[model samples]
Target chain A: MVGLLDYFRSAAGAQKGSASVAKERLQILVAHDRAARGRPSYLPKLEQEILAVIRKYVEVDTDAVSVTYEQEESHEILELNIVLPESSARS
Target chain B: MVGLLDYFRSAAGAQKGSASVAKERLQILVAHDRAARGRPSYLPKLEQEILAVIRKYVEVDTDAVSVTYEQEESHEILELNIVLPESSARS
Candidate 1:
């Protein structure tokens, strides 16, 4: 065997310490970035804030406000969108 | 001294072929999935369609629909969001 180095192999760099630490650091940094760029730092707080903000203004007909993680060029961007009851206007 | 293997250190794993190849494959697969899931795969086509769809439905005050890459659970998800002129309703 030429020594498989992928996730399927034993030496797939899947070691707990190194890779896990790396992943954690990366995620935390990303989360921080999102927070800085007007995204909620924590998931729950973000969800709450998003709903609160949308509900404060628009007449929401459906529950579609959602938050998810996305990596872009090693940076994460948080998106917030809502579906409002059509009243014929754009604000 | 232990050898450094991160992107910052000496053995920075930033080798063109392997890392670039992996990124390419991942991007391709992700783009394919986006196409299957009702997203325009190519940037140009997608932008065109997005504009077409929005224009046909609403009177646009500003352009808002945008597509970008987001990483989630080792996979990338492309999000499409349109900030139409407050014309409400979830269709």
Candidate 2:
């Protein structure tokens, strides 16, 4: 009887652990999806325009420029990263 | 002997499954960390200035605005979300 009880107890514990793990994974995935869906409609156009302006000054691949906008507790941030070809490689 | 072999097989399979799961979680966490670390240093200042400008026009709590920046395969996205208090509540 004790052996059976031990088996059941271990099984329940394992089930609970798996359930919590699944819940955590789901929460993280949902948060990522929500953030993706909340992106502004104008963002693509803005990125394109910015890329165009950068291309005017230097030759760069379309994928070389990255722009990120982040919001913090107190404010909003606009971060732009442009990966230009190495100068030595340009020659 | 057959039962013992079956037990070993199941144990090995479980170990393999957990190892893969751990590896996948680590990869996702590492990617998130890398993206966060790549953020520009000027982002905080930019966010502060933007908040100040917005505050000039409307009163809002510090957490009412959220910004997210994402880099996609072909382009980068800058997303901004702002939550304003209901006008009805103002009266």
Candidate 3:
């Protein structure tokens, strides 16, 4: 088997180090896995529906609305953020 | 400004709903931002150096080794996982 160092030096080109790349990939995979596995599948749907209802009253960027869950020990917190458009904010 | 629902129905084509896609992308971005912002810049480099040293003794897939820091309130946990090749395990 090729040693890790040899693989690094040869296959990896020993370039400045791809550790940041690996970390980035790992972070993404971990977050997706955590979200997909830990939350009820309906959460995202519920958020969308909530966004739908909220739209009836406000003119805003769709991307400005969000819903998320935060876990802390045995407690779970649901968080929402919405950014109003400048026209609405001004008025 | 586009109301959220109109934007969703038109821009998003009201296609089955891309809430899941948005959630997935959000999760990835959150993880990356958290990792990049919370940690010192040197952590990834240190992990690579440690991986280099470990390679001297074992034949293993480079990807099999990992280092991560987990947060729990004020406490920080550094975690490492390494899987050795079957040949090395047998010997």
Per-residue CA lDDT of candidate 3, range B1-53, in tens? Answer: 11222221232233224445422211111011122233333324334443444
Q: Which ranges in model 1 have alpha carbons more than 4 Å from their true place?
A: A1-44, A71-74, A88-91, B1-91
Candidate with the greatest lDDT versus the true structure: 3
Which of the predicted structures, 2 or 3, would earn the higher DockQ when compared with the native?
A: 3
DockQ of 1: 0.06
Error of 1 at A56 (Å): 1.2
TM-score for all predictions? 0.24, 0.24, 0.24
Error of 3 at B76 (Å): 3.0
Best by DockQ: 3
- Fraction of the native A-B contacts that model 2 recovers: 0.00
Instruction: State the lDDT of candidate 1 residue by residue for B1-91, as single tens digits.
Output: 0111111121122332333322111111011111112322233333344344334433443444444544323222333434433322223
- Model 1 chain A: weakest 10-residue lDDT segment is A24-33
The alpha-carbon deviation from the true structure for residue B52 of candidate 1, after best TM-score superposition, in angstroms, is 37
Model 1 chain B lowest lDDT segment of ten: B26-35
lDDT of 1 by residue, A1-91 (tens): 0111111122223333343322211111011111123322233343344344334433443454333445433223333333333341224
First chain of candidate 3, TM-score: 0.40
